[model samples]
Target: MTKTFTENDVLKYFYNEVSKLEKEKIEDFLSCNNALTEFYCELLTTEELLEGKLEKPTEKTIQNILDYSNTLCLQN
Candidate 1:
């Protein structure tokens, strides 16, 4: 907690990719600082926003893939 932690460390913690030691240190630091806690919340919200975003293919694209697969199956 005495040493400085960066925003990148916070991002890493949000993604659960931090080491146990680093996560503990970040949590300890965040607990005492209201502003940092708020920022962490923002980071969590941002992460949430970035989740579950799969691109939808057009109908023609889907048809094309199916057609290609059918051809491959016929060849085999």
Candidate 2:
């Protein structure tokens, strides 16, 4: 049976979450479809941009973790 791919499939492909067969299928699909090719490129560019923009835990959060660890360590 022939499987039709969706944008979600493209996302799975982007994240390396798809099987080897699916990956090849999506690669073949993207190469043949201009609109999908553009969309995949956009997804890739957005992923690249988001790499450095992830939010780090706040200082308060870090301190809370440290305090919690200290309490656990003291009890041991």
Counted clashes in each candidate structure: 0, 0
Error of 1 at 41 (Å): 0.7
lDDT of 2 at 58: 94
Clashing pairs in 1: none
Residue 61 lDDT, candidate 1, scale 0-100: 93
- What is the per-residue lDDT of model 2 for residues 1-76, given as tens digits with 9 covering 90 to 100? 7667788889889999999988999998888888888889999899899898988889999999999999999999
What tens digits encode model 1's per-residue C-alpha lDDT throughout 1-76? 2966777778788889999998998999998878778889998787688777768889999999999999999999
Maximum-lDDT candidate: 2
Highest TM-score model number: 2
Off by over 4 Å in 2: 1-4
lDDT of 2 at 66: 99
Each candidate's root-mean-square deviation in Å? Answer: 3.2, 2.4
True-structure RMSD for candidate 2: 2.4
- Candidate 1 stretches with Cα past 4 Å from truth are 57-76
